[model samples]
Target: MRAHHRSRLLAATAAVCALSVALAGCSGTTKKDSKDDAKEKAQNAKADPDAPLKKGLKIAFLPKQINNPYFTVVDKAGIKGIKEFGGKGKEVGPSDPKASSQVSYINTLTQQRQNAILLAANDPNAVCGPLKQAMKQDVKVVSFDSDAGKDCRHVFVNQAGSDRLARQMVQDLSRQIDDKGEIAILSATQNATNQNTWIKIMKDELKKPRYKDVKLVKTAYGDDDDQKSFQETQGLLKAYPKLKGIISPTTVGGAAAARYVSGSKYKGKVVLGGLGTPNQMRKFVKDGTVKEFLLWDAQHLGYLAAYAGAALASGQITGKQGETFKAGKLGKYKVGKDGEVVLGPPTVFTKKNIDKYDF
Candidate 1:
């Protein structure tokens, strides 16, 4: 199978900043400050994998965007997995992937008496209050693809380990650019948890001896919109004519960047690659607009999340380190620190292998 993708976290808009400036009472709270204590309390809950999954369990997969092709594949796979365990499941979310857009769904799911809510958090903390409240009502929360804060969910089914993903992206771009040139990032949102985390690791990865000549020029936000990402790609090129490559770590942004570059004069001159689905990226790769990109099996990611949620909802386990549970047909998985359950590494998709997979 070829490379696949994921999206981003939070971003403060100009209007938001303006409002914050007008209201000096705006308090700044980093991710750690608001979540560390609560996370510690939540992690104290123990696991019991020996118990059987409850019958008639209702699992809801709330993706970043229900309409997004990436999330569509994942949530559908999750729905399939839920049915396999004799649980009722459905995919529900907003058209746009944003933190504020998800709260209402969480509340509705909670009211509907869902046994579990699998989320792909747009922001680490934006939906925390609602999620915590859901937990209070005994609704097991499992976040997948992207993550909510540790304190906010029972388990985070990550597409892959952050460091590994970061290293792969940095290396992929570095290779495409021949390791010596100016590069920029076209990311989903300004404060997206997954986007920022991967960017941070990519920045650190750039510091290694092998990538000494690679200079990072900018990191632009696209708000996960296709047109915005196309414009951002244009802007990056115009602003820095010497820029040799662009990395877009979100599916929307990656495909948009490629679309822009494919028609522009920089088509073959500028290297573009990042997280992308084979379906969306196949044309770009075949056209030579993108050489390769990275992503884990999103189908498995969603499927695993359903099983993990069922485990939590059934008293089979809590989000504790070292807890293991069986995901039907996919085998067993162990919980890691911060209640993380990693799927595995991403695959690279070029013209040679892009056709082999179709998610």
Candidate 2:
């Protein structure tokens, strides 16, 4: 009877062991299934619900010129913004701001199936066809610094409203010239949309009663070439000996004009002002050749541009109207009706404020 009881106990213990094993196996399977489902859900959450499979993508940044300090600063900031915002890209531009050169770059990038292109177009219409083609291939395009054909680019990251920047440039110089003087404009290429738009605003602003005394004698194009801009500066001094001031809206043109006036017989005779990098205008500013200049934070411009492009890439914000998105260090920007991101107001670089900026 004791032996029989022992056998029965062994059978009962065996049954309990098998049941426990079965339960543990079922539990393990359930945990693994739950984990996989959670992982898939998290991945799906990361993807664009509106435009599927948009995260961890790549875009391209094409400035007008690669080596230009303006573009270089933008490129650096673009890389930083991309890294911070979870995207990938590289900054490329032509040796010069030629539409043809940029077209080639665009073609190659499009061929690689790049997700998007962030461009500061050298030529307005020249980029239109290529950009359109990219769009057809399901590639997106964003413009910054300089705009291209509006239809071709999904969004434009304007430094400021065209009217605001234009009027500001003219007004900033008017204050220095005391609202009256013969001021010649040393502009970039005549075809440059930004320069032309700013000049028009300046002209309109000049016609206002407050600036009636401010005479615009001549407008010359440097094609953004240093030598040409310098020559134009000399020509302005010669043609208008009564010229009291000069305004250049191009970074290179402004710096070259400053140097020309600083080294010329017109030194201190004519005040120089316009949009230029603080670092480039420092010597001229100290010597009184350039009293002041105006520009937005160039690095921040790139930072904002990259964020704008990445937002479009990820569908965080579409090129649609009234959309707002965060741009890391640049803060949040709201898109306007035309799908453009306007950066903040221009910060005038003067003696007091110039020293505070490193870039």
Candidate 3:
């Protein structure tokens, strides 16, 4: 990553961390929950080397938000993985995606004594203090999709690098518009770490001489809400009528953007692409409103996150780079330097290949 890009990533991470710290400061309470867990875990660790086996455990897959199609897919996959492994796991998140909301959930989960927490932090480090407390209490902390504090989470399950996802979007959108004309990005929250990272990458990629003809008019935030995304799409069209393309890296934002276009005369005039569910993007594909889009198998992202969490919980593998573990049907995987398990490359969605995928 370039210095500017790296700075943005760190800034996003710091913003989240600052939120967590502020919340902690306001509460003025020590991590009593984590402490209790630590005492119990320590006793169990000494009593039985295979201590986790002696207890019924609850593992949480905490995404940035719940009910969104993207995280829903992940939740479904986590359910399957946990059931297969004979452990309890479920998806839990705030109704809306907010750093403060996530802090509340983390505190509640810690109070409930969840054995492990796999989070896709809404803000880069907003939930870090609570997560750190969980770790202190011997509650395993792992991150997926987006990361929290590095020292707080034992492992981070990454779908891919921000640059990789951004590059793919740029290539897809640029190709649709013949690499010329104005393009606008429909982003999620301005503070969303993953989206901002990808956006930075997209901006950097656009700066290359090969894309000199392509002008990025502006970027707008939808906050990952469907209605907001739809409105944002309209705003983009009004703000840049000559806009040749719109790229929304959020699942909801992309789908909503497509729907808005589907109802307008600009349907074919403006190309649309980004991260959207196959089911949601089907109509746009059929109507030729969207030429192409891309996303990973979200369920698999969740399944892999769970497997990684279980490995860390049982001490089967530490989140060290180059260390590999068997993930049943998903096969063996290695952790990267940042403790993330890359699910695989993003799968491009077009009419021809779209039918082959269910999630």
Candidate 4:
């Protein structure tokens, strides 16, 4: 299944590249023309600085929810990066992961005249209004982990490529279930940009010939709360008696699902995998409830986002494709089309190698 998926992905990627070249030729525009158009678009984009931010910038980070373990670790790393770059960093957000919870914080940050606001949006569109206002006020908005609308943010610091993460989750589940049977997704929030994007890709992956036997039974949201996620997992098992595997792509949801599976009747029968920290999933991996899971370094993701925010604030890069910046300890990163800076590929964790990671 893995080999088949890889081949299909490679073929699809080549086709897309070919289509892009064909389109460029058909448009009767030179490569220089395309580059000039891109530059023009970047110049027209609002809230870019006239010069690179060298020092004395104030950056604030807003995660989906405050006090969550995953965001806590990530935000701490972001703060470290900000200080390293000679900027002041502040972390603030709501305790709940609702779409509207972040609006007040954004307004506050704007009023405080923050140079940059780094955020992980709970809903793709719900926060766009405030973010747009922030941009109007000269606040550089860079989203990480999750994204707001493209017009609302300067750039997105993606933890991993969406297609890669989605395919990997599907592949992991297929391996555990031997390429067959029913599977379900226990995701964070229905409105979460990252979760929704990954779920859409997972659905597309299910249509491939290699996954023909795999049926996606249901998708449930837990709102990123442990008790709610545990209950949602219980409901899924009760609702789908033939469920062979489950994928929870949020750290909170993954750990909560694992906890429920480990203590329930589904412990040995059902396979669980998704994004989780080593500290959170250690027991489940050791007890055989979960075989393998995948996640990137959340701290590194935060670190890269901080640097991107600083670059935008300083006018080093205007969130344009091919724009490059140096991230402390993580080396250089370039923005792709749509102003996305990918951290890297995700790391797969199994019982054999899970112990080596602490976050």
Which candidate leads the pack in lDDT? Answer: 4
Clashing pairs in 2: none
After TM-score superposition, the amount by which residue 56's alpha carbon in candidate 1 deviates from its true location, in angstroms, is: 1.4
Best by TM-score: 1
Q: Give the TM-score of candidate 2.
A: 0.83
> What is the per-residue lDDT of model 3 for residues 1-359, given as tens digits with 9 covering 90 to 100?
59999999989987876778745532445534543453244323421123243124589988888978888888789878887778898878898987667888788888888888988888866787778777776678888887774566777887876678889899888987889999999998877768878888999999988799999999999998999999999999998989999999999999999999999989789999889889888888878988789988887888888877777677665566666776757987887876667888988888898888787
The local distance difference test score of model 1 is: 0.87
Mind sharing the TM-score for model 3? 0.84
Taking the tens digit of each residue's C-alpha lDDT, what string does model 2 give over 111-213? 9888778888878878878877776676768898888856777778988778987887888778877888899899987767788878888899888999888
Per lDDT, what order, best first?
4, 1, 3, 2
Q: List the residue pairs that clash in candidate 3.
A: 16-125, 16-126, 17-125, 34-137
The local distance difference test score of model 2 is: 0.79
Better of 2 and 4 by TM-score: 4
After superposition, which runs of candidate 1 have C-alpha atoms over 4 Å from their true positions? 1-46
After TM-score superposition, the amount by which residue 247's alpha carbon in candidate 1 deviates from its true location, in angstroms, is: 0.8
List, residue by residue over 160-228, the lDDT tens digit for candidate 4: 999999989999889889999999999999899999999999999899999889999999999999999
Best of the two (1, 3) by lDDT: 1
The models' CA-based lDDT, in order, is 0.87, 0.79, 0.81, 0.88
- Candidate 3: lDDT of 96? 92
Count of steric clashes across candidates, in order: 5, 0, 4, 2
Clashing pairs in 1: 9-192, 9-193, 10-191, 10-192, 48-316
